[model samples]
Target: MKDKLARNISIYRKEQGLTQEELAKLLGISFQAVSKWENAQTMPDITLLPALSTILEVSVDKLLGYVAQDKRITIYEDEYQTEDYYWGTEPNTACYQVLQLIPPTKPLKLLDIGCGEGKDAVFFARNGYEVDAFDVTNAGIEKTRRLADRTGVHVNVFKADLLEFRLDTHYDIIFSSGVLHYMKPEYRADIFDNYKRFTNENGMHVFNVFVNKPFIAPPPEKETNAYPWQSGQLLTYYHDWLIRDSAEIVFDCNSSGIPHQHAMTTMVAQKITTSP
Candidate 1:
């Protein structure tokens, strides 16, 4: 896996539109050091990780390249309620954050892969962007459609799996939230490859994935052993195909306020484009 220190510095610097000289002057490092760090010629020392994360407005875990995973350990009902109903959780917030990243409307084409119940789909549709939503589950499709109807939003919902799904066109913004991390990591390689192929050059692609956490089950834990264990789901790693903007997903299985609820990890990412 790639180290995130340099990447974090780069993202923060770009966000603030700070030049190397400016950031270096602030960090008390030479401009050459900033350039070398950004280029990955050398790394920031462990002592600097906290300062870097604070300057970047991201958590130290993210700056240190830590990714979180969801464990999906909640009881069936609470899990369903959290996944389909609550927008505060990471899985739901993942899409919401992506929506904020994109330039508003501007007649863009959008896609929501694995759009369970179309909650985010409806939100995007009502915001005046044309949207196409897809899900692998039949019930999810039906529920998405019902929700779309009730919301009086015009969103085209489809039923298909990533392996079998095809499109005759590309999208300005193609995104999948709360879906990719469920599969084993090997299964995700092809999906990332396809995502790059289907996005236009000037277009952007964004998605959320559960990240690997520090903990996992013991031996004989067949299902959970292979991946990072979060509340109850397996964690996976993902990165920018062309650029490197990444975020984390943490599923809170044992939430302080709610004992019976569980949710999936949510990590948000955006494609980076160079301005002309």
Candidate 2:
């Protein structure tokens, strides 16, 4: 809990564009005290928490690493309840890239972050990669389990909010798809750091995010929580890692029963301990 609180404070502070000194000034405390709280070396005084929460624009519960039970942030929660798979059960083409780049000839652990309906997770499990996947919606979690069971493969599926969840265990391959754009821009750096830190040496990250472009317009789905990334933004985080492949593409979509176009960036980067 302490670790999560520390991380949330750091992330939210940066999100509000406040330096430690600035936050300290606002809270009538010393910067060192703020630093200590962010470092997880000490906890903020109970009296200070409410003020901290107000300044950071987050609730006290979130600051203390708790998500409200009644809150449902995902837009797909209702769509996922339908009998037919909303996004279809076919694995994304990125799964093939994973197979090509790092064939699972040996035992490998994989995690599907923001897994919607479990198509890619089931694909990896069928191909002999130990798979675990999560989504924010309970409906999505149930569908992933149903699909995995029908496919006769095991997938450790669960529900999680991407913002509140952090990887504590190691994985050889980590994959996320269109779901990453839900994260606010300020929170991405720390989230990526956690991901890169928990990945095994020589592990790969297969990810893609919808990118904002002048030529292409937004899709029909007006999702309040979605935040499209800037072009090339995803690659910026992998500067020290080995970039096996990267590309930006424009695609047609009919997600909300309307014809539209979107620009997206895709990357397959590998973690190499030594300079590559």
Output the number of the TM-score-best candidate. Answer: 2
C-alpha RMSD (angstroms) for model 1: 16.7
Cα lDDT listed for each candidate: 0.59, 0.90
- Over the stretch 1-276, how does candidate 1's per-residue lDDT look in tens digits? 133466556655765668889888877789998888877788877787677666766677745545321233212223234335433312355456556767555787889887876788888887777899886555566767777788888889976555334455677778776565444444445455556566765666666544444463232222342344343222233344343244343344433344332233443334444655
lDDT of 2 by residue, 74-125 (tens): 7799999999999999999999999998889999999999998999999999
Candidate 1: list runs displaced more than 4 Å: 1-91, 216-244, 254-275
TM-score of model 2 vs. true structure: 0.90
lDDT of 1: 0.59
